[model samples]
Target chain A: GAGVSQSPSNKVTEKGKDVELRCDPISGHTALYWYRQSLGQGLEFLIYFQGNSAPDKSGLPSDRFSAERTGGSVSTLTIQRTQQEDSAVYLCASSPNPVYEQYFGPGTRLTVT
Target chain B: AQRVTQPEKLLSVFKGAPVELKCNYSYSGSPELFWYVQYSRQRLQLLLRHISRESIKGFTADLNKGETSFHLKKPFAQEEDSAMYYCALKGFGNEKLTFGTGTRLTIIP
Candidate 1:
């Protein structure tokens, strides 16, 4: 079976630019999650989506970070006006339910200069 | 606030030796604990969960509520076990998990 997939495995951008990272969850998965892995922060939860309900945005570090899942399948994480501090590997994961284990993607390495 | 803590940044043991990776967490409520492993050049994947009580590839973790600990261990370490292991916890209501800093384990041959 196909696992979760993320596009543009690596991205490099200027400090003030914006970037969009995409994630395609495993087929039939109804829940999606986004996380960031920085040198010092380990892995921090970003946001989560379950069905048609409002996404859990509590983990978004700032107003510039946002994520959306469409058709209950694919998700996109956008960082607007990114800063050098945003440099890290963005990881995506999916699960059938909140209590189930999640399958993770290879991740997109974002470098903000 | 829910949090997972892996005290060791790195652990090294020879093949066929016993191995233990300590993980402690802090959460106000009952939490679901898990151990995730990432092999060389591979995506992170679930190794075992305390709730399942099933060992995967010879690895097992026990949840101790009194100590707030869920340490992963194996009787005999294998070289293939060398990788980064992360301890994670999910609270009863939260839809996402809080992870720890992770421990890099190396099983020397």
Candidate 2:
């Protein structure tokens, strides 16, 4: 079966610009999640969606960061007014449910200059 | 708040040697524990979960509530075991995972 897939494997943008990262979860998976990975921060959870509704956005660093899932399959993470600190690899994962093992995507490496 | 801690930022061991990667977490209630591994050039993937009590690739972890620990161990390390390991925790039911700082294990051939 095809695993989770992410788009724009790498992105470079200027400060204050906005960027959108896309994620396509595996077929029939009901749970999707976004996370960020960096040098000093390791990996940080950004948001989680269950059937197109985000229940927990606590990990979002700021209001400028938002995510949305549609059709319970595709998700997009948008970072508005990006900063250099926002430079990192954005990862997406999908699971059968919250308790099941998650399958990960290759991730989008965003660079903010 | 829930927190997962991997004390060792990096670990190196010789092939066939015993290995232990420590992971400790602090949470107010019962939480689910997991270990994630990312091999070079590969996406991160689950290595094991405390709830399953199953070993993967010759590695095992035991969750201890008394000490708040879930250390991953392998009796004989292999060269292919080298990778970045992350310890994660989540509240039971629907909850996001909180990950550790991660430990980069380098198995010497």
Candidate 3:
């Protein structure tokens, strides 16, 4: 079975520019999550979506960060006016439920130059 | 706020030697604890979860509520075990995983 997938394995953007990262969750997965991994720091939770319930946006670092899940299958994380601090590997994961084993995709690395 | 902690940023052990990776967490409720691993050039994957109480590839962790720790251990370290290990926790209602800074393990043959 196909696991989760993400687009644009690598991206280099200028500061203050905007970037969009895409994620395709495993089929029939009811839960999707986004995280960021930076050097020295661990994976930071960004956002989460489950079924049709309102997405949990608590982890978004700032107002510039946003994400949306369409048709409950794919999700896109957008960063507007990105900063140097936003440079990191963005990871997406999916699971059958909130407590189930999460399958992770090969993250998209974003570098703010 | 719930949080996970992995004290060691890096660890190295000889092959066939006993191995232990420390992990501690802080959460008010009974949290779901998990250990995730990522090998070189491979995507992150679930290694084990406390609730399952099952060992994966000879690795096991016992959740100690009194100590607020869920440290992963293996009787004999294998070269393939060398990778990054992360400790994570999910609170009952939060449902979002809180991860700790990962520990990179290297097995010396």
Candidate 4:
């Protein structure tokens, strides 16, 4: 079966710019999550979506970060006015349900110069 | 707030030697503990979960509520085991996970 997939394996952008990272979850997954990995922060949860319910944005670092999952399948994480601190690997994962194991994608490595 | 801690930032062990990667967590309620591993150039993947009580790739972890810990252990380490290991915790019914900083395990062959 096809696992989770992410686009733009690597991205380099200047500060103050905006970038969008994409994610495609498994066919029947109902839960999608975005996480960030960095040298200093390890892995930090960003947001999560479960079915048609409200998305959990508690872990988002700031207002500049946002994400949307459409049709319960694909998700996109957008960072506005990017900062150097945002340079890290953006990861996406999906699970069949709340209690199932999450499958992760290759991730998009973002660099802010 | 829920939190996971991997005390050691790095661990090194020789082939065939015993290895232990310590992990501790803090949470207000019942927590689901998990070990995630990432090999070089590979995406993070689940290594094992405390609830499963099953070993993966010769690795096993036991949840100790009294100590608030779930340490991963392997009787015999292998070179292939070298990777970054992250300990994570999810509160009951919570979709988000609190992750540790991670431990880079280096298997000396």
**Index of the highest-lDDT prediction:** 3
For model 1, residues B1-109, the per-residue Cα lDDT tens digits are: 9988899999999999999999999999999999999999999999998889998999999999999999999999999999999999999889798999999999999
Give interface RMSD, every candidate, in order: 1.0, 1.0, 0.7, 0.8
Worst 10 residues of 2 chain A by lDDT: A50-59
Model 4 Cα shift for residue A38 (angstroms): 1.5
Better of 1 and 4 by DockQ: 1
Candidate that beats the other on lDDT, 1 or 4, i.e. the better one: 4
- The C-alpha TM-scores of every prediction are 0.98, 0.97, 0.99, 0.98
Better of 1 and 2 by TM-score: 1
Q: After superposing candidate 3, which stretches have Cα over 4 Å from the reference? A: none
lDDT of 1 by residue, A9-73 (tens): 99999999999999999999899999999986668999999989999999999999999888999
For residues B41-103, write the lDDT of model 3, one tens digit per residue: 999999999989998999999999999999999999999999999999999988788999999
Native A-B contacts reproduced, model 1:
0.88
Better of 2 and 4 by TM-score: 4
Give the alpha carbon lDDT tens digit for every residue of B1-109 in model 2.
Answer: 8899999998999999999999999998999999999999999999999999998999999999999999999999999999999999988664688899999999999
Report lDDT (Cα) of residue B72, candidate 4: 96
Categorize the docking of model 4.
high
Clashing pairs in 4: none
